[model samples]
Target: MKTETKIMASILIFIAILLAGAVFFLSGDQKTMSQGEGNQLTYKIDYSNGQKIGSDSAKIKLVEFSDFQCPACKGFEPFLKQALTDYKNDILFVYKHFPLPQHLNAKTAANMAEYAATEGKFWQMHDKLFETQEQWSALKDPTEFFIKLGKEIGLDETKSREAIEKSLYNNLISRHKDEGINLEVSATPTVFLNGVKLKLQKFSDLTQEIQKQL
Candidate 1:
């Protein structure tokens, strides 16, 4: 009977520790990152390279490290997009590249988006890529397909080919990927809000956090 009581007390203490951690999470710890569900980490944030939208002076910076060929990134795209639209006036939304090696076309996709950025069409190309990701994601080579996408979004096809062929934005994409690694991003669509990594499984998870900051 005494042994049972001690075990029960230990379990209660463990539960209390978990509750305290939840409270800390609610307190808005800004220096830590969660790599998916259970892994928590702390890493520095850098945005010297990315396509940006929204308020330049906003207190909240919502940053996404995404891979073009990543389906999980695609799945989360809508929620992230809605959050950006909803919080456009209240936060700075920046999209960075984190193309995985397995996704053959991912790096090319990033280059094409950056190519489009030069023509002031980054977001347009971005939408085009994700919208048609399934079509070109599996190709043995996707550069020509990317040029087709470029033309679809009003980018000059010949210039797009030149950009792809020359790999003009590869350096920029490389820098973005390196930055994501530095931030300890282990998966696609890793997002950080005001320096705190968010576990966003639904729209509410994001909006509620944004509201907390606002």
Candidate 2:
């Protein structure tokens, strides 16, 4: 009788282990599905959509999803500018918007930059926003500040103001964010060399990566 009881206890333990594993696997699958909402994840580069500079036919594409209000992005600007200047013929640099929710002025600044793009002056506004990020980023309403920046970059004040008020570039900005999300970009200054996402610790890291592809 005692031997029979031991056998039954072992059988119950084995069954419990199997049930636990099944639960774990199902929960793991559910977590993954819930995170991405059961949709197919797409990760592809749109070569022409973002603000681009350098040789159109260049073999290396350096794409950066950045926010103007991010200090780290600002800190990385000089290095990127130097790189752009240094590799004008070899590298095609594309700038996409990825304004984090924590930064209040980032999206507005991105809109102004996009508006400037329509006037054939995106890079100019891009520089202006990063240059004055500290000042305008703190204002209660950065609309006037951004318009002022637009003016500094030769964007028409009335048109810039209207665009900001109307949020004309919202769709484009959202699309950029969506693309970043698909690529699992959770931080500003997420850069991709060609299609492979880069883990950038510094400008030297970027230099080495670019050299490898060149």
Candidate 3:
């Protein structure tokens, strides 16, 4: 009788262990599903002033930290642009610079972008920069190209060049970086939506997330 009881106890312990393992597996799966449903952009983030474009008041806001020379950033540009166009009334997108030191032209490009912002042409220059990335990327005279591009886009070339020289938006750029660092951004093209790091895997993923927030 005692031997029989021991055998039953052992069986029950084994069953309990199996049940616990199953629970753990299921919990992990649920967590993955939950995370997948959220913003795919993974980066630590902090905000300052919060007065920047797209930050003040919007149904949904996306903050993108990017490098001008980053291939990934370039690749993701189209999807981002589509988001802006598709959700113009529902979403506001903000750009931040996190130019990597390895890219020789990235920092300069960032500076130029900041200067463009001062001229009230940030978005226009932003589009031109990304559209003409390949042309100016390999050249040593990227500034001239940017200047010309600005003129083509109705920006005052003389004023634009002067803005770049004077670094008019230098403080704003620095503020963006400072805020990004505080937010724990360690990479380029990190995006956040409504204060959450987007978990977006593709344009579709972003669209779904935006729909939820809206």
Candidate 4:
């Protein structure tokens, strides 16, 4: 009787130890998960000031920082457009200027887009700039091309030229670029979905991320 009682007591103690360890292990895992989530960087961006093309009450806000002269940005244009079209109701897409210093014409293009905005031709000029990026990228001066594009988009040639020459939207463009720099955007076409920077290899990957947010 005494031996049996001792044996039972030992068994109970071992079981208690095991239960305590299991609880600690589970709590540790939960702590680790919480820490990982907390470590994720969420940027605070002003989407209202940028060129927006979606519903204001969208659940998902996508902000794109791009350089007009960057080929990758041009390539991503179609995919971006498609995503906006497909998720128009759920997503608010904002285009922010981040013209790389290496690209002489990129800042000018961004300035032109902002100027076009004044005349209600921003989207048209934006598309035209990206569509014909290759044609004007290598020029010593792309002002002529921009003026021509302005004409095609029904912008006053003289006003467009003055905008470029006088840097009419310089402050706005500079602000956008500065904000991109502060956000650590090292490459063209850097994208953020709901303040979380995305590493997308393809357009489909972007769609997947958007769907996940939705």
Candidate 5:
């Protein structure tokens, strides 16, 4: 009888040890997951080279990785503009190039914007590109329209054409795309607010987050 009792106690002790080990492992895994979430929330975003739309010293910085030819990006543009207007005093908005492979005119548009940047008219060109995205996106070759838009924005036709034809800003566009890739950006309108990636369901979602930061 004593022997059986000792054996039962031994079994209970073994089960307890197994349960304790599992709890320890699960707790360790939870800790690792928490750390990963913290890291993602605090990931650093680089905005040194993109087009800026607001004061650089603003407390809230909103960065967007965008493709000019993307329909969704086109849809998001108005809300983005409104955000800029609403938070004009408190936000620094930056647009970074992330032209998707499927969008034929996206890279060209990015190049044109970069050329416009050289002429100090990037924001104007940015608005023109999105405002007229449908007209140029369907064209087999949009260079002529790009030049026309450039002229509208007061950029020198010769310099703009030269920049577009020779892809003078291809390297810069590629750099921005690379930066977006490094940040795991796979879509046209990936947005980051103050270095944290935001999954925006509505315009108010963005504004609420901005208000929190402000």
Candidate 6:
């Protein structure tokens, strides 16, 4: 009888320890998010262009801070493209970066895409990066992957490589990040329609909310 009680007590103790560890891990993640200066984001003011593809003076100005390696951002792309198609004359789209550290290749991918922006291939490279995210995101050397993507998009490989190597638009990327932080972006794939936060859950939610605003 005593042995049975000891066994049950041991099992309970193990479960308690497991639960405590899980709580600790989750808390650490929250702490990391709130760790920056002022414990909040501060976006620097800059009017520099960021790979503008559509009309600059559209009625709806949408700014998105996303990571190339983020799956949620990938899922949101089709919806965004469809929005452009549906509201062609009404929206001006802007892209920015908020790369999470867990996704190792996001920063380089963002920088490379910024370089591609110089050649008018930002959107193309942006789409391609999301399309091939699973391939290069985990690799130690993303050069070949980036090169292949540039070739696929018909960009000058030499220019693309040189741009990334030189950290072309590095300052612009930094400014975008700072801007996003200042705007209270705590995660990748944050979208603002006319400077108002888009409460995202599904496609219909985006269309309905945006349509109302329009």
Top-TM-score candidate index:
4
Candidate 2 wrongly placed segments (more than 4 Å): 1-43
- Local distance difference test, each candidate: 0.82, 0.84, 0.71, 0.87, 0.86, 0.76
Clashes of 3: 10
**Model 6 TM-score?**
0.74
Candidate 3 per-residue lDDT, tens place, 14-88, comes to 999999999898676452233433344233334443224543466887888887888778888887777777888
Pairs clashing within candidate 3: 39-198, 39-199, 40-198, 40-199, 40-200, 41-198, 41-199, 44-183, 45-183, 46-183
Judged by lDDT relative to the true structure, which candidate is superior, 1 or 2? 2
Which regions in candidate 6 have their CA more than 4 angstroms from the true location? Answer: 1-48
Better of 3 and 5 by lDDT: 5
RMSD of each: 8.0, 6.4, 7.9, 9.8, 6.3, 10.8
**Residue clash pairs of candidate 6:** 43-178, 43-182
Question: Residue 17, candidate 1: how far off, in angstroms?
Answer: 31
Tens digit of per-residue lDDT, candidate 4, span 97-151: 9888899999889888999999888999999999999899999888989999999
lDDT of 1 at 185: 82
Please report the candidate that would top lDDT against the real structure.
4
Candidate 6, residue 21: the lDDT equals 100
Return the TM-score for each candidate structure.
Answer: 0.78, 0.79, 0.68, 0.81, 0.80, 0.74
Better lDDT candidate (1, 3): 1
Q: Could you tell me the lDDT of residue 181 within candidate 4? A: 78
Give the CA lDDT, 0 to 100, for residue 130 in model 2: 84
lDDT of 2 by residue, 7-105 (tens): 999999999999999989867655323332235332467778788888778988989999999999998888888777777889999889999999988
Q: Over the stretch 181-210, how does candidate 1's per-residue lDDT look in tens digits?
A: 767788888888877777776645878888
Q: TM-score of the candidate numbered 3?
A: 0.68
Which scores greater on TM-score, model 1 or model 6?
Answer: 1
